[model samples]
Target: MAVWDFAMPSPLHLCRAFHNSWASWTASEARLRIATSASDTTPLPAEAIHAPPLPPPVDTVYCSTDAGFSGPDRSPTFGFYVRSMDGAFVAAASGPLACPYDPLLAEAMAIHEALSWLQEHNYHNVQILSDCAVLVASFRDAGSYRSYLGIVLDSCLRLINSFPACSVKFVRRGSNLVAHALAKHVSAVEARTVWRDSLPPFISPAMI
Candidate 1:
């Protein structure tokens, strides 16, 4: 029997190590038994006994929208993202130079861009994530839209309804950095029309 060292740093590494050990045992005449030593009978520390639960992996996509001002008064940029469960890029968008002082309008434009990008690729079952409460709430209640926002709200609703199983969820602002960053990029580049699929090199780092 071969005595293998424990304390590997990664689960994948540990799996490979154990598989190799088992193979080695099979080739040898001796049998292998995984028994703990007497000192190992002591209870593990609380942190060791209970591993932190990982964030739920989602086939899940994330989208974020951000608003920026062109001249400290006119908000010009809006950006959004859509990612797969392993955080691979799916769809993304930005509406640069919106020139709308109303942040909600900028947010709506970003949402519209994201939806249009998704629709082009025929993505139906999706969960649109955002940090904009007003925009998300508008989807939940018919009354959330009023005046100009009413038009934007109506457009968003129509886009969402076109898909069979789609939902808009509001996450905390802290969780929406990716989308917000895209929006800023849009403004800086002054991009016209919509962007899709391609992601900036910097954004890929945070991705799983």
Candidate 2:
């Protein structure tokens, strides 16, 4: 090793060098911490993990319904998806209306069709979710039954009452996207489709 160059590196240079090194080290540590914090950060408005919906009573089937409208004044498609209370795929069905109906009536029609299918298949224990505020309102708000759409709502309620155990309730639109996608599928095909085993590829995302 060479002898200490005391003359070359005077007190001023040594002090300057030490100060520079300390600053660089502090900056490096700060940068490291910043990078570590960035890498570990969760997305903004970090989503809270929510408790799952409570499991329904034994042997209950869960169903969701949505209506898809193709274009202005054109026919609408109705879609419904069914799953066991355990969230296993039970069945799915979709069909286009014989005649184009408004959103409220169309959604009520969707529930009517879905309940009919469930009843036919002997699925007496059923819980249905619909994202149609108007249709659900018809059931909840008695005043809404005055219109012609009330016909479909009455039919749906009649079917619901016939079941040994059944409920039709409203949920947020996001919770019913599977049925919305199914409606799109049928609208594309322009025909009725039913799934007893595997569902359509379009619905795979909901499975995940």
The local distance difference test score of model 1 is 0.68
- Each model's lDDT: 0.68, 0.80
Runs in model 2 with CA error above 4 Å? 1-55, 71-73, 142-144, 186-189, 206-208
Model 1 agreement with the true structure over 1-208: per-residue lDDT tens digits: 3344854357787789999999887766343222434445787899977988755434446555556555555547767777776667776666665445777777776777777677777876777787888778776665555677777778888888997667788988888887777776634446654445477655655532
Tens digits of per-residue lDDT for model 2 on 1-208? 2246654566787789889999999999999999999999976543445545665679998999988777555668888999887788889888887545577777878888899999999987898899877667678754457776767777777898999888878899888888888887734337888989977777776432
